[model samples]
Target chain A: MEKTWNNKAWFMVLPVLVLVAFSAVIPLMTVVNYSVQDTFGNNEFFWAGTDWFLDVLESDRFWDALTRNLIFSAIILAIEIPLGIVIALNMPKKGIGVPICLVLMALPLLIPWNVVGTIWQVFGRVDIGLLGRTLATLGINYNYVQNPLDAWVTLIIMDVWHWTSLVVLLCYAGLVSIPDAYYQAAKIDGASRWSVFRYIQLPKMKRVLLIAFLLRFMDSFMIYTEPFVVTGGGPGNSTTFLSIDLVKMAIGQFDLGPAAALSIIYFLIILLLSWIFYTVMTTSDAQG
Target chain B: MDFSWMAWTLPTALFFLAIALMLVGMGVWEYVSPGGNPRVGVLRFETTRGDRLFVSLLGSAFIHLAWLGLVGANLWWALALSAIYAIGVFRYV
Candidate 1:
């Protein structure tokens, strides 16, 4: 059958275009407008060129927050990807157990991010929280409120508890899509368990793994609400990722120009890094 | 028509206009010459004309940003560097 190019087909896409314009483009334009201007608090503004971008780029505070964000994202990807794969591998393939496992895995991801943070905030309290009191009873000086390391540990664990389920579900979906024929063939070949996984399972899961990696990376990189609620970027700016810093600059201090510039820079960094990750992963996937 | 609430400035508006123009131009170019003829280059991944354009634009942004960060606020040299980078991307990438 031959395909016809109809101009009316564009009408189908018009709704999405309008929605995107309203949701993304308008807000982004407002940010861009603020980025290169100085405001004197009377709704009066003046052109400032790239001065704010320069200031944000030069500021140690901005750099420190960016560094923390990158490190946090790296640690998350490191922990979640493998942990999700392991959990997915262990998940029962069929019967009543499958639905139960899936529902259990999905429960954490269904919770709101702020709610997850709030849960951890109370759950890590030394006086009342289970984990904190247990550690305290074991002679561990665990105080997320007072110690930076403890704060980081709590945040990372909370994030893992919250988001690892997403990876598990994606990987499990990928794993379940594999047919019985492949396994039968592997068994006939008398392949070792590791060999079967390396050759059959890993290759099958590559696409979902890539999706999981990108989603996790982007989400972890822009993480704000969870850490903000849990730590409030406190213990003296220890957990202040880029979003938290941008908020503090924009709303907290009312430095609209610099904050807007920082937002642009932050968005660009994520775009650039995600593109790089996509390119690299897909390239490797094509080759191997 | 009342963009006063947005606090739009001349330079910023012009900047957005230029970007919109580029996107329109790209659309026109694609309509005229479809397929884009993806090819592998220095990056070792297949990319079409639009991909190269995106890469160049993204690179140019970073170059300008780095210039602002490392050197002074004068952006003439940064613009020059970005133009060269765009040409290189179109040619090679």
Candidate 2:
């Protein structure tokens, strides 16, 4: 069948394009403007060509935050991806329980980022917080505000609790989309549960899993609000991902030039990593 | 100190009027395009459950504001309430 191309479809996309340009592109341009210029308190900008960028590149703080972000993203991907798949596998494929299970899994992803932090903050409190009080009662001495390890653990747990559902949902979508004929063929061939998952389910889930990985990686690398809300990036900067550090530099210290440069660099890193992820996943899909 | 009734009554009435405006706007939209919701596109992208979830999030933002006004910025309570609202939306909406 020959397909007719309709140019008017572009008009349909115009509203979203306008919205995105305003919300995303304009802010980005402003950031770029700030990055390339020096600003004083009176909202006056002076041209400072490459000076702030050079300073940011040379700064140890930027490097440390970048490393922390990379490590956190890696840790989250490692934990959540496998755990999500396992949870999805365990969930009932068909029954009255399916919607119930799905709803329960989706509960965490609904909470706002700051609120996720707050929930963990109170939950980890030694007084009225459940986890903290229980730990203290058992002589575990857990305090996120005072201890770096505790803060890191609390942040990771909070993120996993909140985001693992996303992974599960993606994986579930993949699993459910597989044809019944494929399962029937696998069953007729006397395939085991492990074999069925590996040969049939995993392959079907590859695309959504790639998407899940990318989304999780990008979000985890840019994690700010939850950690900021929970620990305020304290306990000796243990939970200070790049986003938190950027906000701290820009909003807290009001170092516009350096912060702008850092922000651009951070944005570029995310863009680059996402591009790389997309390339690798697509290439693998083509090969497979 | 005797509080003035007009101060409370006027603000409350105006607040409700603003809410009524949003409801009327939604009703007009539903009336105009009954088959396809005008705001469906905004809801469909980003998340799977679509625009209903987004609408629920919008509603919860109002709830959060009300909580802040009434309960002195209890973050955990607000968070929990919002989460419950989202969950309710997932099932019912």
Extract clashing residue pairs from model 1. none
Q: Where is the poorest 10-residue window by lDDT in model 2 chain A?
A: A41-50
Tell me each candidate's TM-score: 0.98, 0.74
DockQ of each: 0.81, 0.01
lDDT tens digits by residue: candidate 1, A133-228: 999999999999999999999999999999999999999999999999999999999999999899999999999999999999999999999999
| Candidate 2 lDDT tens digits, A124-223 | 9988999999999999989999998998889889889999999999999999999999999998999999999998999999999999999999989888
What value does the lDDT take at residue A241 in candidate 1? 94
DockQ of 1: 0.81
Q: Is the docking of candidate 2 incorrect, acceptable, medium or high quality?
A: incorrect
lDDT of 2 by residue, B28-76 (tens): 6656766433222322322234345444656575565456545644547
Worst 10 residues of 1 chain A by lDDT: A40-49
**Could you give the interface RMSD of each candidate, to one decimal?**
1.1, 21.3
